[model samples]
Target: MSRPIMSKATALKISRAQFDINKIRFFDFLNYKFRFLFFCWFDLPCYFISKGQYNFAARVACTELSSYAAMYFLARWNFKPTLFVFLLPFAILRLGLMIGNWGQHALVDDVDPDSDFRSSVTLIDVPSNRFYLNDGYHTSHHLNPLRHWRDHPHAFLTAKDRYSNEGALVFQIIDYLEITYRLSTKNYIYLARQLVLIGSQVGMSQEELAAMLRLKTRKFSEKEIAIELKK
Candidate 1:
């Protein structure tokens, strides 16, 4: 697969910001670049339906509608006075869920993309994990989703070699939100710096590691997903 260089727009964007990551983040916030994606709930039902999963899609659609209806009724049908109040927490929760998922599964290996360890990430020292209860062990969650939260880290440690073989990525002192931001901006240099070398990756150079990470972030086609799923 061909790797993409930064686009002209991206070049201009970085230039305008003087290559500052914080400025890029601020600009992206003003642009609502990820907000639409963060509201993944809005398109999910339609997405499922398009893939010919009518039952699950219908349930999702109906449940979403009913939830909104309940919220509106709770607000006494007053949009200005109370709708924002009701939506405040719900929107926050939804955005968090979507953003976490995005960050978790963002770096799927171009090869072996179907491997759970290869697809999701393990985050250490992320503050939200303490509050959200094991949100940081997303790779282990994907490995066996029903596993109790407390056992997640243990599981990863036990299968450390497998994770290393699958080329799993881990980060310390970085939360999912920052992961999402870094990936969105294609800041591979920063990501390479943060990578926790589990096994085979110990001797890799920053450029080589960045290239691998960049390749993982590329969008897979339906054909690619279908191919991956078969194996």
Candidate 2:
């Protein structure tokens, strides 16, 4: 059977065209200057609002705020971490989640670059899944946002064959942060070494996997994106 395809990659590419948030400097910019106020007030709303975006907003506010908020109230809370708990959705956590999203959706097949199955990655046996409700199964989330988190492992196992066909990236002993870091540093050898091959991919050599990964991470030209969108 042929691999499954979805238009998410096209949407993701168009979204990424404006910003390369993978850089640590970009991160510094977001972290400094409370620039996120601008994101909250103007940038994001002017751009788009997905439920995931709102979920990210709420999740950051609820999670990080408590720890930071507690610290602030107890002592001389740095005006940065405490008073801005609510603003974390825009600042601290938004920047963080963008890194995760970049890692999750970084690899795109040159021929089928717009296909969700070809673009997103899944990390297995990663600790983040334990803490964040199976967030390692990002490809599954992209496949079906409504699917329960507990069911992701089962879903992935059952559909392993399809995932293999799509050449979907699967990793072990790593999380999105590591993936993002490795990609940013151009560490394809390590990434390929860590990649968990499935089905037809079982025989792929390390060099071949590294080459494929390099191709996956390359930015498609405007003409390429236009052609993919037209498809």
Candidate 3:
């Protein structure tokens, strides 16, 4: 599969066009620049690290920490009160994670069973309809950040859409979230607390969270499936 690269032209154009001219103060622009530059600097390193190069992981970590430092300096520049307010908790958690030894366990990938030991989705390599945005596995995310695989008709209609057709191993989102969130928030009590708060804010009940966790680790038993079907 062809890997996706965020185009510099696209990034700049989007940044300038989407941003409010009057609203973006000097500090806001600086923060935006910080985020963009950090993304650029770490992009290649992240790819290399994902390829199993330990040295690349170290380099990426170093650069990522530096980028976060830059982001901190530029945070005050942001003028979007609403965005800043919404981002504060996540941002603060991220910054804290970057500092502690717990940073070693930072979660990088999506919460997918297919993502656990390896990738879950298998695609046709023809690259015809694959515009890298709509179909290009990873690039598609850049194009449509919120488009979920489950929402696709081909996948949603079938009992084994991602699992069988795409060669993906489907698992409960709650399961993925619990493991990843716990690992990422290790030693970061504020983040741990924030996670609980976020869970509550999202309207997930404790029973639901436990059920998801159980599903994540438990293999799919035919009996369970039968029981679910009966319900």
Candidate 4:
């Protein structure tokens, strides 16, 4: 059966929201900065590894791998033993996830660049004000996190859009891992752990640290969590 398309109304709503978010001071700049920086960072290394300058391919790998890492470490607190037990398996899994993501980059070439895209769900980013749901199962997981794999399509159908073939595979990996994490841990604590991990790695500045910690913002809010999910 053919997949349902995003209705014009839904698309317009999502697009407008995206535009609104894109116009946000912090998110607009932050999104572009990270997207470009990571695109260059990963793309260059991938070139050395792939022996060619397939920059677009590298960017997609970077996006997928980063998304997978976010989903993985954000969800599960489990640790795998390394040469140093204290070292934990998160690093190894993150590396493996990136390599796996690089392999999956091959599939991006299979997609039509002109393919229309829209997200059914919406996120209000108080940070950059950029609305995002490019890989949307993250949104689905947030909405009905208790739902399992085989049951997802039923839930997804309720949403106005679904991923194309290539997008589905990437989303599935992240979604499954996310679900597993939801089943194993409390969402807020998991989020806090993820915040600390990302904060430490990025050498978060005071402003960025305050933003992530919401120290200036007060109690954690779902709306805030939704914004973080998009990042």
Candidate 4 lDDT, 81-143, residue by residue in tens: 322343335445554433322222211111221122212222121221122222233334434
List candidate 2 segments past 4 Å from native.
Answer: 1-11, 14-16, 19-85, 88-90
Flag regions of model 4 displaced more than 4 Å. 1-83, 88-90, 109-111, 114-155, 160-231
Off by over 4 Å in 3: 1-90, 93-118, 121-150, 153-162, 165-167, 173-175, 181-231
lDDT of 3 by residue, 94-196 (tens): 4442222111112212233223211211222323224322231322333233456433324323433323333232222122223334433332232223232
In candidate 1, what are the lDDT values of residues 93-127, reduced to their tens digit?
A: 66675555556656766666556776678987778
| Pairs that clash in candidate 2 | none
- Tell me how far the alpha carbon of residue 25 in candidate 2 is from the true structure, in angstroms, after superposition: 7.2
Tens-digit lDDT track for model 2 on 1-231? 111222474345533443343333554434433444333334333232332466545544555456555655744646565545544554567667666665776676777766667778888888988988898887887788778889889999999889988778899998998887898787888999898987666888998888888877666677777676565
What is candidate 3's CA lDDT for residue 187?
A: 24
Better structure of 1 and 4 per TM-score: 1
Question: Backbone collision count in every prediction?
Answer: 0, 0, 3, 3
Pull out the clashing pairs in model 3.
Answer: 27-77, 28-77, 133-140
- Candidate 3 lDDT trough over 10 residues, lowest sum: 100-109
Model 3 residue 189 lDDT score: 32
- Stretches off by above 4 angstroms in model 1 are 1-65, 229-231
| Alpha carbon deviation, residue 100, candidate 2 (Å) | 1.2
